[model samples]
Target: MDPPPPPQPPQFSLIPPSQIPPPQQNSNPNIQPDSIPNWDQNPNLTHYLDLSVPKKRRRGRSQRNSALFRSPLTLNASSNNDLSSYAITSSSSSAAVAPPVSFSSIRNPPPSLTQSSSAYDFSDEIIMINKEPKTEAMIALSAGFPADSLSEEEIETGVIPVIGGIEQDKTPTEPSKPGVIIIGAGLAGLAAARQLMRFGFKVTVLEGRKRAGGRVYTKKMEVGSRVGAVAELGGSVLTGTLGNPLGIVARQLGDVLHKVRDKCPLYSVDGKPVNPDMDMKVESAFNRLLDKASRLRQLMGEVSVDVSLGAALETFRQVYKDAVNDEEMKLFNWHLANLEYANAGLISHLSLAFWDQDDPYDMGGDHCFLPGGNGKLVQALAENVPIFYEKTVHTIRYGSDGVQVIAGSQVFEGDMALCTVPLGVLKKGSIKFIPELPQRKLDGIRRLGFGLLNKLCHSCWWSPVDCFSGR
Candidate 1:
């Protein structure tokens, strides 16, 4: 029989906790380091990007497998608040003395490895790591894994390994808490930050746009003699009231939300009211088309093929040629336009398989909307959260230690990072990943479609002699 395989080093998981300590506003009145820290004075900050450790080819299957091990520490953040940047101090018994390394200063390296700053700054928080010997406990502890998560042998040894180039902490009493970096300051990002902060995480939000409200925009309009009025330009309505996350938040924030009125008056091209019988016929035709499309979609699913709703509608129109005339067909198309309007996409691009997907609670029928618009939702979530705006993140690099985000010349580092960018932006391939994403994920990104919906809000003056005069 083959001999038992050699033992492998304990794998370190760098999964960031949901929360850390809430980030307190920077209390240092004299110092303002909101943007990238001034690294010119301390060139050592640039060394953080260096991979000086030489690579070696491993011989056996065991060594080869170990070589392939990659840490899951890739916390990617966008242009914004991610986490607290702290100082990192390292020391060795063999080397008589060495300077402490700052996590923010990792981008630079000093000319001499032996030289280190003699003065210690306790005010600058340090990530404490014990330096003894490489063991399962050490790797687990360094990555912030709980003691119970380890095995019996790992618990017994309690050895701590020192990563190369990075020195161990002189004091191990106070271990630095993990932090999370959130990209995007929209509703989801801000909401995530709020929850994570409550969980005791130091959270930072980065927004590429100047404002926090991602796609939720509210526009104000004032016409000739009319007073001010607001219109929802994005994400207007709440699908339901019961168990609706947005509705719950609106209630907590004391915002007014009313159920939308479903009634709409139909008129002819000449501005005359359409006959009630013609309206009923148009409505009936639309309903029939929807039913036909559903059946066609079911049949297409059996063949493992997907088609657009527009394609299905055309097929329905072809089959029910005598049901409606050209004018009636146009009216039916107008009613069905709501589907495209709601999705901000055309039927030609919408997937028939998932186009009708919606929450079952919504079927109960009352759709609600905020009079002030969805921007109120954004404001409620972004409260107290620090957001860095206008910083376009270009790249994210993660490893066993932490994640580093690069936007322009600035670098934001944290234990974990969350990306809340729009699917449209991600599909553009503007931001690049370090190791590259898997093929299936990239394929999904391509398969998924993004749509654009335009809104034009304006006020018009009506005179008695105008079209209304005919009524």
Candidate 2:
């Protein structure tokens, strides 16, 4: 019978031979009975078969199914040793079947290890393969995985993955330069902005008023046929030409400066011209009294109680008052009023200790006036600088993270903030600080005095002869 069908190979099964069900007989006439192994004959034969040798290759339908469900054996030594240690146990089954392996399961192994037959022995290779795909955290935790292997959900939520108990931020660092917010578009603020911009910083200036120049205001006067002359309603004169900031700006703009002469024509309160000789004598006496007061302050040294400059000057004036006539005394009083005007405050409020402290730093040379008002200098400095006007910043919230300035309904954020607002504004509490200013600063602001100066510009057409003569 076809040479005894070449000894049909025995089928392997985990189940015992007695419990295994017999195979169904093939009904096809073309198939010979000798080709199929009879399970009834010698049932215990499969028990004695060697399992160490790999299963024989099959053909046709069985081969195709085996290829699809076959689990791959890792060629590592540890994996081979672990596989060899596994004990072969029999179950109530016809043939040995391997679990199906998926592509993802092979690529990303499970985190847990499989236990071998021996107690306390664990297999290094992950055998508990999941049917479903691996998750993002599992893939990231796997060794040799790329750093950017974050899931779509993690990326969208900006969640950084934790590896080995340490969280890592994979986002790239920002390359842009820092930004600065400057309050008040005054000269100080504008100058700082320009300098910062040159150094590659982004700057924004917030100004409360409609125009710049801060307290330096210039107004054009056109009063009936007088050639439109510009009047300085605020700061007008450049105190010194040598080393003066405004002087430098004037030179840059190619503008001319007018020097003011030290000539004063005194007039009595009764509208009578005073003798120039008497005017000179009183002025000298007043200056001598001021020098004497300064010397006295130096001699007295530091005192616990502070006295007003006016009080000290008055004390010195009594000694000199006996030598001058009443008209000359009136001229001296006028000089005192001029001194108050220069200080921009009443002599009663001026501090005796620090009233003339800044005199030594005064720029030497001629005191000059800019012809078109100092507003031109402001314009020159403000060129190309982005200034937001009427942005009255009412609140400032600053911290290590940066600063937030709230101007009306608009909010501005920057890496740093510069406050160039006048001390008067701070003292008035117009702009509220998130954390209130320090007690010391508040005390100083309260102690310091701010004075107001009012100017009245007159447009008069009269001849010098008529003006000087009692008109």
Candidate 3:
């Protein structure tokens, strides 16, 4: 027996990026009871989340070499606006040149995170992480490779030879603060940087992508000479606006928030709308499934064996067969498929045993979507921080002293580091770690899986429909 085809992952409806479904268009003025809306060749229909294929892994030296290189770079911080850093590359042992590279720019900045005049202030109390807790000022622990790994010859000649006037006087000032280095400028990384900055810690963010936002992306439409429509290519909705941090930020930014709900108009293949009776049946099945999923315990005092939703759904079918007819079941299946979007994976991967173990957050409010995509939130949070674009981190070395990050051709050192790279990237092993990670951490990294969700945006169109004709 071919091991009964692997359980298919749950499927989610491909909603247009804006969650704005085009209304059915009909030529007939007087619509018939069975008249279905024609969606064939609809130009306005957009495919929001296209999970047709798996995501491709990042390529280049980071994926291949995965080696660590420590180079001393020059930082010109005299003028905040003209602050730029450069890395030197040597051709032959004879000579090389250091190209001027603009690391980051500080434009008209946002309000400070706190009452402090600037975001780079040090407090009396020292904050340390992941080592013997010490209370003092700044400190830098050396983070070089194992002594045995480096040859004596290589060690003696490791200093990057400067071909230009790039060297600056190593003037000793008040020992600088122990800074933080954040890899990946995605939402999570940006959020961490923002919080750390608010706490008066220096932070430098390295982003592989040109833009700041990672998963949160927005695409703008343009007409012949002017901009037209706008839609989100990633992260469309905020599940609950109330008590949601992102929602709060959106509201503060003066972005229009549209309230959305679970209810949506349903039509059959021929455009015939599902009758109220059938709709009720679909809703009942969905509710029952939710109830069953919530009941994590088995009969009496035994623990329930966790199974995929597909498996438990079969049990539901036996119990509620009478209430759900074939037609209704089809509609229910359509609704159930939407779970894929929420979970970002197949139902088989979801565990019924600990589904809701992490105290889910639901404030009983309408789902909201920011008219201006989530990229705005990313931009807002990335203010005042130095972010190096197109810096793909290849390896990280952390120890009692601090952390050193090597990305592309640049090297960054900091007091601590926050690795916000997606699990997919981590699983690909694109990055190497010095001294290696613990077995348990490695196991967790391998065990957990990441999913892919893509979005496509198109023009928006709308038409009206009436579902009461059958009644």
Q: Write the per-residue lDDT of candidate 1 for residues 220-310, one digit (tens) a residue.
A: 5545655355667676767545334566466545566776656566776789876778777766666676665554433333221345666
Model 2: residues with Cα > 4 Å off, grouped in runs? 1-176, 222-227, 322-325, 458-471
In candidate 3, which residue pairs get closer than 3 Å at backbone N, Cα or C atoms, i.e. clash? 9-346, 10-346, 10-347, 36-271, 37-271, 141-401
- What's each prediction's TM-score? 0.55, 0.57, 0.58
lDDT against the true structure, per candidate, is 0.50, 0.52, 0.48
User: By lDDT, highest first, what's the ranking?
Assistant: 2, 1, 3
User: Highest lDDT among the candidates is held by which one?
Assistant: 2
Candidate 2 residue-wise lDDT, 147-195, digit = tens: 1223342222222223235443332233245889999988788777765
In the predicted model 2, the residue pairs found to clash are 14-90, 14-91, 15-91
- Residue-level lDDT tens digits of model 3 in 1-471: 567874343442321223221123332333222332111222111111111111111111111110111112222232322223222233222123244333331111112211122122111110111121221101101111121122222222122111124432222232244688999988888876665654456789999999888877766655555445556776667765533457645644556677654556678777998897777766666766655433322210012233554455545555557335667766766655565444555555655444333222222245777755576787776765579999999999989998989997778998988899888888989888886888898999987754566555555333221100110
What value of lDDT does candidate 3 attain over all alpha carbons? 0.48
lDDT of 2 at 134: 33
Question: How many clashing residue pairs are found in candidate 1?
Answer: 23
lDDT over C-alpha atoms for residue 233 of model 2: 78
Better of 1 and 2 by lDDT: 2
Which regions of candidate 1 are displaced past 4 Å? 1-177, 220-227, 296-301, 304-308, 343-352, 357-365, 459-471
Better of 1 and 3 by TM-score: 3
